[model samples]
Target: MNQLLWMAVGAGAVLSIEGLYWLYWRYVGSGSVRDYINEDQEPEGDYRILRKIKTPNQRIALVEYRGQMWIYGNGDVMFSTTEDENMYAEAMVHIPMAAAGKRNKVLIIGGGGGVTTREALRYSEVEEITAVDVDDVMLEFGKHLEAMVRFNRGSLNHPKVRTVIEDGRTFIENTPMKWDVIVIDVPEPTGRYPRLSRLFSVEFYRLLKERLEPEGAINIACSTSFWMPEYFWSIQETLKKAGFQVLPFHHFVPEDGEDWAFCLATTSPVDTDGLRMLVSTEYLTPERLKDMFYMPFYFANGQNQGDIQTDDNTVLLDIVSEADYEQDGNRKEYN
Candidate 1:
């Protein structure tokens, strides 16, 4: 009987080890399901390849991962359909438009899918919108994808919307004219690409600050509240150090299973009151604006909680460490 009990204990230990190995391989080692799939060869509607298109410049794919449409360019998944893409586009574009008080001559830095351009045109007061996106294939795929096209119907073909195929950083550096409103809709910095990392740097925000009109606002998609607290704070701090009054806001995206944050920094305060006045088709009301500022204790406490910022160094790394601790604690409790 003792021999049998010992044998059972040994088998249980082996099974436990195997279970841990599988969990690690599934979550961290293999990366997310959205990241691993090669959209080029994946057949459409096969629980993969939501849609695929190849343009002259690059290959783009749209896949339904995590219950939202994700745009992949040159094998890199760019923006996902977070929140209602329409609601997000409307809030980002219209808030700044109303704040600017003049809609003519706008510059959209990264809205390749044309959602922002569509919302910008809704006012009818805006004369021209120059949209600069690095991925040309994304535009092509979006045009062909019925649901995507429907999101911004007729806006891509609108006479006022001129699509400029170029890098956003290069466009900003070389463009001669100043913009009334500059909507920066770039992806979060994952350290995957050096150019993406540069967007979060102090120098880059300074360049963006220089290009803006005295009252013009820059709206950037910040990182998720869950995965990267350090990244979000670093971005906010970098913008603040670059000399803009920063206002941070978040919107919940059910499909992404995360609350996405956005930072609006400008020489002038963003007209939250003016934004409240807009005839919103969605639910971005004054109360909602207030709610966006409310962060949970875990996220709020993790911000500068256990970090020391010196003159020579930034607290980005420390903030990330605290966030990780909180995330792991929550995971353990739930599991």
Candidate 2:
């Protein structure tokens, strides 16, 4: 009996050691999913990785799924690589046309995959588009990624578009050049990562106001209002605190499966009547844009409890934390 007990203890010790090593090998030792797969050979199924970069901010990946490419950051799909007529990319394109009647110089923050800059280039009045992002590898890889370059209609390679590899906050704070249109095509503040929380803070919004021309306008991604109203309200409050007249709007994105919200803000009131959708787009029209201003009853009155995000305090991060979303049934199980 004593010898049997000794053998059992030894087995348990070996199993424990193996488990710990397995954990380390699975996460720390192996870099990313891309590291395990061969570049020349196609991945198991229809999905194929075009490019993958592990940035300090997040793990960025360009994945091809079912013949379509997707830009994913930190396990969340930011947008589709293919140019879908009914996607958010189309709606965001019309923002410059709707807000800034004359687009001369535009600044795009977090315009990954180069779609936003592509959309902005459609305006004949637009002269230059500067896109800034933190991940240098992703930006460099985007230049060569066939799916991304083609989807943007070669806008990434256009002479008018200038790409900058730097943190969005630092770039905006240091830049002296003011912009006619500033588009914040950033990721949603889901609090899965802390680095993204600062972008939605009141301090950042204030910085954005400083960078805009007197006649300039800004576009912000407020996330989906379908199941998360607090997230939308928090952004509105922060933007208002930064001293801008905010116009909140929502549109149902087919790829997102939720009513995503965006805010058009300027120092002065935006005359929607005078605004015209000069660029032909599949998603946004004059009639559809009119309905975006009216918020649904449930979405407008949801229980939004959280602190206002500031430079010192990232309250928005706590509001949309992945743990909280998991508990609240807001996040899908597979996602």
Candidate 3:
């Protein structure tokens, strides 16, 4: 009977060790294993999953981390409860507005979580904001998700805001209103993003420029300058083809994990004179703004590496795919 009791205790010890290892793997190791899991698990510590949903359109998740909520969609960080001037969303919104020199009426295309609208609302001169997003699911996240609504500072339902569920190209084609600033805050064109190719095409830029008021400027969310330098160059050339003077700039967004590029294009000359920030920004000093427009000499050497995207010829996807695959290869080699 004593021997049997010792065996039982030994089995319990083994079971306890295995159980602890399993918990560690599930919480920590799972994140490191490639293809081990499709989604992120609830992180350790104060971070907790408030809600997670995988819709046909995209995966939406809300998590509380460091005393704030972060919204992720399709593995990309979308919005966070932390509102700082250095955040990418805030800087992107304010950049074009500053370049425009007027914030009277604004139109935001592909504003997934209403964060851009929230930033735009900081300008009292912004009379109305129309946020057009193709995905109703994303708009619903902005509207129904408590954490998301809080991050957007109630701008989703603000009197100055109007949410429209429509394709950005179609909205620009049909809307009668002209905007002083048009902000394109859509997802990047990489990784199975649907219908984003045409949005980056020359045809789309022409349509966007048509909806801009005279002296108005448009800002497009080009991909990261680090991994996707060619992508930014292609956009600059494409915008020039559409008859707008392009000024390329980049901001390092901590949540994005890279330095993101934004292109400010205008039918008229881009005038920095009298440029003033209506809203306080953390990273966009006047000196920094001037420096952001300068491209490294190496990038300028290969201006025509790829064809500019058009309605008939969509090649931005291929370019982004190639760049991303190269990054994957480098990662594998390092490993």
- Please list the C-alpha lDDT of all candidates, in the order they appear: 0.65, 0.73, 0.73
> Model 3 has how many clashing residue pairs?
0
lDDT of 1 at 240: 78
Pick out the ten consecutive residues of candidate 1 with the lowest summed lDDT.
Answer: 305-314
Better of 1 and 2 by lDDT: 2
For residues 1-335, what per-residue lDDT tens digits would candidate 2 score against the true structure? 99999999999999999998887774467744534232322334767666677777776777777888766776666656654523677666576556764589999888767787788888888889998888876676557777777777777688999999888989988888888898887866554467777788888999988888877888888766354566777787788788988777777656636687888888888877667677887767778777767666634624543346787876667656643546545554211
C-alpha TM-score for every candidate: 0.71, 0.80, 0.80
| Model 2 TM-score, 2 decimals | 0.80
Q: What value does the lDDT take at residue 160 in candidate 3?
A: 87
**Cα RMSD (Å) per model?**
8.2, 7.0, 4.7
Question: Per-residue lDDT of 1-335 in model 1, one digit per residue for the tens?
Answer: 99999999999999999999887764456533334343332324635555556565445667775556677754554555554566677667765666664667788887778788877877766888888887776665445556667667756668888888887878877876787788888754332333455555676678888888777877777656555555666677778778888777777766646576777777877655446535555756678766766665434534432322232443554444455466646632210
Model 3 ranges with Cα > 4 A deviation: 1-47, 83-86, 253-257, 297-306, 331-335
Rate residue 182 of model 1 by lDDT.
84
